[model samples]
Target: MTRRILENSKVLITGGAGFIGSNLTETLLNQNNQVTVLDNFSTGKMENLLPFFSRKNFRLIVGDIRDLDRCREAVQGQEYVLHEAALGSVPRSVKDPMTTTAVNVLGFVNMLYAAQKAGVKRFVYAASSSTYGDSVSLPKVEEQIGRPLSPYAITKYTNELYAENFHALYGIDTVGLRYFNVFGRRQDPDGVYAAVIPKFVKSLLEHKSPTINGDGSFSRDFTYVENVVLANQLALLAEAPEAVNQVYNIASGERMTLNELFFCLRDNLAAFDLEIGKVNPVYGPVRAGDIPHSQACIEKAKARLGYAPVFDVRSGLREATKWYFENL
Candidate 1:
């Protein structure tokens, strides 16, 4: 196992009550770091943070990112900032661009500016694969990107630009991790804008048919949350001048169609209950702002940040399925 790079530090996770944020907080707390979470709990669940409520090292700030004072208060004396607080979902963005822009764009700037003023060592924020809109590439790369297809994508790409500008102008070190479809434990499956993996798992568990937005042939580089956590750590560890102030794709480096993903989830969960295997999927119209395919070229991350994804999609699905079966 690679050694843990971040330990005994004061770190702040902006969306600490959310799935990826909670996972990062849990791991960091165990590694002997003092972790604080700033979340308004709009989409984040208190259930996710309930386990850590009693921990002396864990502090919770009940505030929204759109509030600059809250953002400033959260970053006080923090060595690093994992900026994961942003409104997600392309469909939701398409539905209400104003709300998405306010939170994902304006709120993002608030957090970034806060981290800068506090003299934080490194600011690592979550970018998105949606930024690779309409690009007909097999494996998406960092330097190459197409026009954003959604407001959410625009916000994420804007974040990249802001981070770069911040680094160039203010000299605050920043790293942007362009995460693909991230999933795992603590990922909420009940919301209207629920992610595909957990939503599918939840549906099958109830013996209900899950609807595929497209023909199910659209592929994605579905990354497991554990790999994303590791990438965050690596991004923190990468102190080289070139490594900082840049974005890297945090993904499995493999691709699978939505149909294959559904079957994988079905087959994995079916081992516990055969009824789950009998469940069928319903087809629906294609959603706006969704690309036909998405895969990542991890060579840059591997070479620059020494990031190697430890879990493939199937292995991640197995782990995520077991969690859903037990917890859901």
Candidate 2:
């Protein structure tokens, strides 16, 4: 894939005001792409995109994907669509499955239809690690997915199905990236469904004891945000026809227990504040719809999409800790 493909190209990012979306927006804008952000701001914070407001190549359209007409409007004239908008979190989906299905599943179909109608070149979307639910596999492969454990996981899995069907039925190129515990700067730490990393960082920063949902033995392949952005970029620019219409694991290809993650953060953050290393986490019951462990086999992605993760968990954690310490 050449840089010229993204340069001066019109790209639309759904949920552009959110953490991953905002990061992608910044990267694409820096690369001289004309980027349009479509976000409803439900979970996405406006502050995330504040830095890009003045950029001439950046545009923000406050809209929801649940509305088909709005999806059509966002897809128009856009050569590529990076669909990142979704209601994320297992507990949130369990509490409100209807809304989750509406946004993640129905909204996904709306985007696909609109993008197909608009003749968009590629549709790259966010799949989830939760799709490996109940499988108990050490290194998850793309083909061997288990039944979804939560409504959120179900919605993401359904998205892969829809994207594949869209490709088969309509010939619209699609790529699904199964993200594994992505974390970085600008990740929200104050919400009910806040991800573990940011939430832990925030609690430790405030000198509050972070709560571990389980025994801290549950592990994840905590990939960094920049790696995910690279996967999206490569998926958009992939030349091989075999790479299109397939799913790839976007991860660091390593796993760390929650306890290990906690200590790593503490040790890293201790450089800024000596007292941070002393903070201990409170262990609690395991949350529902969570897998015991997760790791990824990235050979498929390496062979197909040329994805080489730039940051491992420890390095990514160091970078993320620095950002949270300074920004939060």
Candidate 3:
């Protein structure tokens, strides 16, 4: 009776009002699942859920994960938990390491504790490619890791460590998805800590020069949001016990330099009759806590969770560009 094999499941997505969380919420609701969104709206906005406010199976609770009681209440009667709440910007973390540590580390532990107590079926949370840090590996594998260069990376790594210990000690099933540069619709571009794609798109639209950090040589495996949603879905549905208590890299499995992204955006905009010529990007010093390059080895995810990313960087950028043109 289930459509797409995900009907009537009780799903909980922490930070469901944020970019990735909102996308996951809409996708789950479309599949006829009972969905609950736990968000404090610190970085997330209420407008993100404007489309699904009327859905009978969808509910939203404005609360902080740091509050254990609220976390427990939100986890009650939920089968799957997608914990995506955290202060995401590396630069912001560099500026305010203490707040980042408290929310990302302490709040994550609180959510895990509450989810464990509620007997959740699976815990799938947002890990990051930044966890690779200074590995210098071309395609970052799951087993090999390096010292975290940023506080944000450190917090995400801590999430995986906590997940492993929880499974070993408490028998809780958990999966950590190391998301690469995820970008697409609903990504906040107006903020100081905004991710690159949205920020660039906004800058280009406004005739402002987009700043490229580190001479645009620093590359990233820019992933789309849909791929991350697919990873979470697979992590929750995978029957192999080995899939649990493990981490998988969720990305397009390709790389792009910031310079390449800039030109691509310019060209795409030109196609829409928005001619932006000879866009000379402003160069800035390298960020305080940024890895030089990052790419992902997604074969392990394919082998274990059957995770397949449908959108590449170009495809995702095209989609995102269209969204910006229409919405902005």
TM-score of 3: 0.97
Question: How far off is model 2, as Cα RMSD?
Answer: 1.3
| lDDT per residue as tens, model 1, 1-328 | 7545789999999889999999999999999899999999988889998999888999999999999999999999999999999899999999999999999989999998999999999999999999998889879999999999999999999999999998889999999999999999989998889999989999999999999988899999999999999999999989678888889999999999999999999999999999998999999999888889999999999988999988998999999999999999
Per-candidate TM-score against the hidden true structure: 0.99, 0.98, 0.97
Cα lDDT tens digits, model 2, 1-328, are: 4332367799999999999999999999998999999999999999999999899999999999999999999998999999999999999999999999999999999999999999999999999988888887779999998888999999999999999999999999999999999999999999889999999999999988999988999999999898999899989999898999999999999999999999999999999999998899999999988889999999999998888898899999999999999999
The parts of candidate 1 lying over 4 Å away from their true place are none
What overall lDDT, based on C-alpha atoms, would model 1 receive against the true structure? Answer: 0.93
Candidate 2, TM-score vs. the true structure? Answer: 0.98
For each of the candidates, the C-alpha root-mean-square deviation to the true structure, in angstroms, is 0.8, 1.3, 1.8
Model 3, which residues run further than 4 Å from truth?
A: 1-5
Evaluate residue 63 in candidate 2 and report its C-alpha lDDT on the 0 to 100 scale.
Answer: 94
Q: Is candidate 2 or candidate 3 better by lDDT?
A: 2
lDDT score of residue 162 within candidate 3: 96
